[model samples]
Target: MAPKRRRTVDNESKEAVQNRSSMVTRSRSAKYVKISDNNNSPVVVFAHGAGAPSSSEWMIRWKNLLADSLNAVEVVTFDYPYISQRKPPPKAEKLIEFHSDIVKMTAAKYPHHPLILAGKSMGSRVSCMVAAENGIRASAVVCLGYPLKGSKGAIRDEPLLQLTVPTMFVQGTKDGLCSLESLEVVMKKMKAVSKLHVVENGDHSMKIAKKNLELAGISQEEAEQSAVQAIAMFVSQTIGAM
Candidate 1:
């Protein structure tokens, strides 16, 4: 009798199958796309804060700012499954898994370019968890309004400690959700190359008082522009180092 040959499973095909099977059937949250002028530029995958969808005003504005000002970066934003549903938000571990899957899918789609994981609040926390667990290396991570801890709660320090990629935390000086003091302590313990940019008198949503804005002779639009410029500069420097 002739020896029978065994067929090896194709890893790529297997992944595709798993991805398809794991997708949620319901339309939970929305996904938005902003294309950049520079073709083949690096991609910035953004995750929104808890309870907010990708179409939220903040995410839309950030996407536009990055796409228009960054020159060579495309921005993609997606909502977590929990937020996609009208139900309560998922637990942190579940959110992390969702973020990881989104990153993997985004990377697979744009295999030619590097990825930068950028998130706001809870989204940023989830991004950090994904990056650490998968050993995925991004050009950099832009954490906008990172939530170090909730009010009257103990802070989660593991994500910052385990991060190995270049990270920039853009925070408001007066953010109540995550205090500046707590963030400063956490930043000191981060293992990765990290920098913090504090927006003077800004709140948890990075919104400053109208009086201050007027005094600075800057509009809300201008503040957003400044933030985009800062992010672009950080990305440029981090990519250069790589």
Candidate 2:
């Protein structure tokens, strides 16, 4: 009887341990994403581009820049499930639902504060889609390198047309996927207030050419810093007007 009781106790203890481990794994995967250490209002929920994860250099840099620059804006970053699972990049259309869910969750978590949906490249497109389709009210949307047209000249202007909220696009002048001309044409049809801040001679990643940097009398780091500063300004002004 004593041996049987000991066996039961051990089993219970092992079960408890397993339960704890499972919880930890779930928590880790849950993306407990809060922007900045302090509680700041008007959180900017940023989504990473198709090519990179939320922890990539570009995402981290922008996250820190927005957090520090805005002072009041907490910049939250998140990863898509496919990226989390280390799977190949899925179609952008397939990703809109997932990204919208995160945005909705973030909005629900902080009900009082306003939200600014911002994303990089493909992520930016996703943000626009969510803002247009889902009824989640974002104060504004910022697209850091909007892919207006695919490399094969396939245009994706529907999302831009559907948005009724104020939007700001920070586009690189030299980006192949989104030529300045193509984006301008699409912007004309958008009813919402929109602004385009051009990054002179920058690529899709907003990396300025070395020659262009020399022309601006700034280093590569300075060029990126300048772009971030511009983004910070746009966020501040947009949020302030609202």
Candidate 3:
């Protein structure tokens, strides 16, 4: 009998199976958080403020709020070294590399989705700096109560000026750290397109004073909901333009 013919079809099928298995293993190893069941939705990498860890109640609340408002598939939040290691917080510049790494990893896991960098006060400032860095192609940035002033009340406009990506600022009218009037001036100087949503009488944390809430005839939840809605609109417009 002639030499048995090699089973080319079987060999090819076996190779294909191995390739698929490898892909599955890689997928399983990649870390990611799913905020919604929707596929290919935007991914938000949210950083916490210097005073709080990623697990803080405040961070948790806003993370969920952002996911719902932006229709994001994932909202990834990571604690900085200080928060995670119980060390003193470092300068915002010092945290940029680590923050960029998290953003990159999250982007890699959701390669098909748009990336949005967002954060509270100090975190928001850092996010802007990271967004301005090389190789971070964030679709947009959401700055929740951006700290436009330093400890000594000096303007901190460098990061905002450096941003090349569209940005949305949800600022509190009552936030001493970022006066709306001063932000207006800074926004005028910024090179990137920027939008603002003023939270009347809200503090640095977007917390509306109970008295102010009563005066405005709206509940705290309602005010926050309105802010989130504004963010949604900003995100939609930004993505649509892109």
Candidate 4:
């Protein structure tokens, strides 16, 4: 007799089976805030950076800003277990599995909606890893304050290199973690279509100097708003292409 194939459901996607019953309940300290102007809009799930909880001022500001700025898209933000537990974050590789679980839960819950994974700094790297490993294609990815290198100046381009989906990277001009010159080199080597937006004089957190903002004839708010808008525009174009 011929060997028989194992049963497969939902078009035989392992991602479907692996996460089918693995829906993650939002932790006690976690929240699922959604912003949607249109029901048909793509779902944008944002993971918090390594150092900050989802409720941190930076995350809160961007959560509200991206939701408001992205307008039509639905944006959801959540905290990592370490952040919720008040402990030091695990190494980057260790967080990918957990991050993937959260993302898979979100995607499964919103099965029909186009999904977009986004993150800040270390979170961005995790997003890319999940997309690459899970076999689930995201419409696009938006990397806010991507940490291209560690504090020790070691390049972290492997995750960026493995991404198969379009990725837009919003980096601060002065961010030591992501040296523009080095990032450009990695981008050139990437097979994925990559776009970069430089936040003039901004740092790791994308904070601009009041002096520089004054010289540029734009308010700090305007500089910040531009960063959000750039990501919004990237989503718009990417969604349009899809």
Off by over 4 Å in 1: 1-40
Residue-wise C-alpha lDDT for candidate 4, range 1-242, written one tens digit per residue: 11111111121233533453332111111122323455446777888888888888988888787777666345788877887677998888888777777777777888877788889888888888887875576888888889988868799899888887888888877898997778777877787777776676889988878776666666666666666656676677777777
- Give the per-residue Cα lDDT of candidate 3 at 88: 81
Tell me the tens digit of each residue's lDDT in model 1 across 13-129: 434233433421221121223224444367888888885788998889887776665554468888777664688776566887768877887888877776889888888888888
Error of 2 at 72 (Å): 4.2
- List of clashing residue pairs for candidate 1: 28-84, 29-84
How much does candidate 4 score in TM-score? 0.81
Model with the higher TM-score, candidate 1 or 4: 4
Top TM-score hit: 3
Off by over 4 Å in 4: 1-40
- 120-231 per-residue lDDT for model 3 (tens digits): 9889999999999899999999999898889887899999989888888887778989987687667767788787776767899989787776666666666676677667
**Best of the candidates, lDDT:** 3
Q: Which 10-residue span in candidate 4 carries the lowest summed lDDT? A: 2-11
Better of 1 and 3 by TM-score: 3
lDDT order of candidates, top first = 3, 4, 2, 1
Of 3 and 4, the candidate ranking higher by TM-score: 3
Clashes of each: 2, 0, 0, 0
lDDT of residue 60 for candidate 4: 80
Residue-level lDDT of model 2, residues 165-191, one tens digit each, is 778787777798898667766766687
